[model samples]
Target chain A: MRHGRRRGRLTRVSSTKDKLLDATVETLRTHGIAGVSARTIAATAGVNQALVFYHFGSVDQLLAAACATATAQRVEVFHERFAEVGSLRELLAVGRELHTVERGTGHVAVLAQLLAGAQSDPRLGEATAAALDMWARELETVLDHVLRRTPLAGIADVAGLARAAAAAFIGIELYEGADPQGAGSALDALDQLGAILEAFDDLGPVASRALRAKVRQVTSK
Target chain B: MRHGRRRGRLTRVSSTKDKLLDATVETLRTHGIAGVSARTIAATAGVNQALVFYHFGSVDQLLAAACATATAQRVEVFHERFAEVGSLRELLAVGRELHTVERGTGHVAVLAQLLAGAQSDPRLGEATAAALDMWARELETVLDHVLRRTPLAGIADVAGLARAAAAAFIGIELYEGADPQGAGSALDALDQLGAILEAFDDLGPVASRALRAKVRQVTSK
Candidate 1:
């Protein structure tokens, strides 16, 4: 009896709900929060407007669920990759790679806009916190490995470093939402730093230690 | 006759408009976008709901104007202070001081939410651009002078650096809108860099040149 197949329940909004969630994500990117409403989102989803309240109760809850679903999927995928991170160099490289696709798909803007929206809505605030918590955990895994190679590891708070890195990524993406043209120069600076970091990677462990020694000297003064 | 003071129009929404804008700001802070409406805003402003349409044409336009007005005022204050920045150290110090007050006043989150909302509405989009442009110009002035002091002066692109710094500030503030406690560590890293830069400041031109030479070694490798 436990292994026997059972008929799917008719109560769940699985097929219709999935459509609504997808529509919510797309609407958020194109129209933003103000433009989102039961009528608009239902039209996009090709469903009746009445079903919006019937299925989700309200527009706010629908949008929050969309954000949470999208973010959770991305986090799961990234965490799988993060689990194998071997160095700080590889960590940044992975970031650069993801930035490319996420930007193209509007994922970056969706997350950024949702974060801004989260401040205004309690349901969204809760969803955003869960998303950030997932990211923080993923980053913590990478940072643990990264700080070990650097000379400042002893003084650096590993958890704080992870949080800061996560913050920087979110910050950079949000800034990009406001100014697209300004992005090239900003990305260029980061690329240059990435190249410098790569160079530090090519050097042997002894040289890496010496370089961090220099960083320690600069930071101490 | 032209110089004579004209009697103020009794029907004008100028006083009422200001009151509505102020109410919008408060509503945005406490209720987010979903709570904002002609009814709620008017109730908060203690005015007739129909006046929201009479003065601003739509709620979207009213919110846009409120954001633009708040941003322009903040820009003017910062530009006055930025004009005096001769070094990067002073720039960060001023930023740190302003961050404390802006957070308490909820100005940071207000601007951030409006920015995300801006993406949905064209009028808000235009206003946000103007605000960002003003901030960019102010930052350029400081970066141009600051770049002259360090080794990066010769190698770094002043305009590019200015844009990156501007993007970083926006990004940092936006991130803080979602995560308040996480700010101190991100800011701490910047302060550590600030201290590093201050050391570069204390060194004379000869030492500065030597430091740049040292930087050239690590980066070029």
Candidate 2:
């Protein structure tokens, strides 16, 4: 009888923890970082405020957990899509799709809040960076696969390109909030770059050789 | 004597306001957005907390004023240098110099906090975006001048490029906090892009025409 009751309690605890995480993300989406607190999160979760401290030790820890958990889930959902990206342009197309869905789901707002909160909290910054890295790592894999066939193969730093691409998307996401037209233009510019790369890839062997030599000569300088 | 005293009083009031503005920026630099308050700003300014409200009406107003005032001064300082940029490579070089200087002066940190704070605050968002526009405008002018001679002049969107460049830098600055090496790579990637543009400028007429046509074709598609 005691074992059965303990098992039931364990399930309840796990469910409450999940509820708290969801509530934290929701609060960040709706209230921004400033609106987040144990009271608010617990209220959103429909549980006692003490459970936050009990489960996560503090609100900051809960925030970090929530961000990491949510990002992991989101990244998992896109893993196959990211794997299917065959070209730089296709990668960008996926990015656009992801951006649209993330914006609609209010995850973009949640990201902004976490990034803002991270500035003031080191623990949160570490967690936020970790979450960001998950995306960067996925991008790096694709970049490695795609760039290997391009003139930029060895010359470009694939790792850096991955982070840069991730960062650019993050910046555009936030920038869109302030200047939608400018953001759209930035997106278009990226597409243009993608198209240019595709054109480079389409070059005949002799032209490709010449282009590679030129790219090498310029980058080396 | 009465007129002299009135002028002296006006000078003191202006000086106090300046002190508050400077303090607000300092507070943001050191404490992040979460640490900013009338109490903190006044403490940093060595004035009574009431002075913050008395001069700027509210903490948010003070932050907006400080961001605008500081950005204007920084942009003004760079006006001559920006005008001297004769090439995309030079512009990137200037961007590097500016990044280093801004990072050293803690303005980058302030920018991060403002961007974060802006996520939740519409008024702050307006002020931050306006400040960002100041940089974008400067970049747009330079892009117009440099790209005018390049194949990309009519093809690329200069206005969008300016905002994109500005956003990229902003993203890079923030991303640097999470991954310094990756940030360096991103900067190098930009430099590579600049070098490519420079190389395109060095192309012989026939090659340039061919490249331009190819670019147009790809972009049109």
Candidate 3:
């Protein structure tokens, strides 16, 4: 395998893949999925078209690899930043960080293209969906841990609630990026997250108690 | 100028425009934005090459017009639905209706295209931004009226909250639609909306007190 041929050339092999992924992200950023062609990606990566094929097998495969790389990075960041928050309030703070990086850094742009492409391309859709599910599960674990420590009435519903929260966060991220000026200052994103956390804090004791109990059951078991 | 045309003749005149818009939606739906082209739209619409210009003035204008037409109808539906909801829960029920239709219909396919396109296209970005703002405002009005007597603290924040809520709703709409399974059942969409509203409701005293005060302030002013 080329993996063996490149034993001492680890940097070269990795750089080739990195260059290809970077080029893919740029292509998606500028041209979107439709505008992404093997030739364009090869040109952007400064490699021969054949080299691209050699590394990734095909254009579609190359795109999937690029998207997978981006998705994994986002998941890692989300987990790294959000994994320690022990309460909903703390999680809202995490939301601020995620939203800032997602909108300001062009991460969402790449995801958007990949997501849109996923509509027509099943392989892409499956890969993206799997990444999303992984993110959700990671968050759920955090939620389960928190609820177990502080049982609330609605705790059993924590997984569903967590999924909804994650979905809402992504939605705000997309909307903010789509129209930066109208969405207002970056602080507005934080404020929005604060409002959601505040609302959750306001829940009735019965609901809260139920949440706590349910989450404890799920996580402890 | 052609407003004077009789309904029968109007059909003839507008058919080209309608076809163009329909074609734009179709092109957007199948291929997403990057694949959308004036020539492809023209061919899809079955219009002569020059007619796209005759009807929409430019390709950009054509895309804008199509997006406006697609978004406007939903806005109209939203406006009508809110008029009937007299409380926060009821207002959310109305939101559920809008979400149901938006998710179930093939509208999301085109919407995803418009959103992805908006990332790179300035004109489209402005148009998409404006549409979302309009939806947010409508939601604010509904929340204010429903919580009119409540004590919720953020009347001024109503617009922001409404925007956030709508963003969440829309994010799910677009994401679910683009998924391999396509739209989920209407009950599924409504159930998600219900969970969000339930979370707000659980916030109970805090939400009520803050909202009531905000409502009073707005109504007084």
Q: By lDDT, who's the top model here?
A: 2
By lDDT, rank the candidates, best first.
2, 1, 3
TM-score for the A-chain in each candidate structure: 0.77, 0.86, 0.73
Q: What value does the lDDT take at residue A27 in candidate 3?
A: 80
* Cα lDDT computed for each candidate against the true fold: 0.67, 0.78, 0.64
Tens digits of per-residue lDDT for model 3, A1-221: 22323345544344767778878988887776767888899799897778778888888788888877777777777777776887665776676677667765566667766776776677777766665566667777776766564424233455555555555555665566577654543235335444443444545667666444433543343
Cα lDDT tens digits, model 1, B1-221, are 11122254354344777788878887777666646788888999999999999999999889888887777667676677777777776888787877776776666567666677766666776766666666667777777777785656665544555656555565566556566666566676666555444444444565555555554653454
TM-scores vs. true structure, each candidate: 0.77, 0.88, 0.79
Sorted by DockQ, highest first, which candidate order results?
2, 3, 1
lDDT of 2 by residue, B1-221 (tens): 12123344644344777888878889887677877889998999899999888888999999998888888878888889999999888999999999898887767567667766777688988988898889889988998998888867788767777877777777777777666677788887777766655655655666666666766775676
TM-score of chain B of each: 0.76, 0.87, 0.72
TM-score-better candidate, 1 vs 3: 3
Candidate 3 lDDT score at position B205? 64
- Model 1 segments more than 4 A misplaced: A1-14, A48-58, A80-93, A193-221, B1-14, B83-87, B196-221
The 10 consecutive residues of candidate 1 chain B with the worst lDDT sum are B1-10
Residue-wise lDDT of candidate 3 within B107-178, one digit each (tens)?
655765676777667787777777777777787788787656543434435666677776666556555644
Q: Can you tell me which runs of candidate 2 are displaced by over 4 Å?
A: A1-14, A204-221, B1-14, B204-221
Better of 2 and 3 by DockQ: 2
Summarize candidate 2's per-residue lDDT along A118-209 as a digit string, tens digits.
76588988887887789889989988888878867887667767877877777777777766777788877777666656555655566666
- For model 3, how big is the iRMS in angstroms? 6.3
Ranking by TM-score: 2, 3, 1
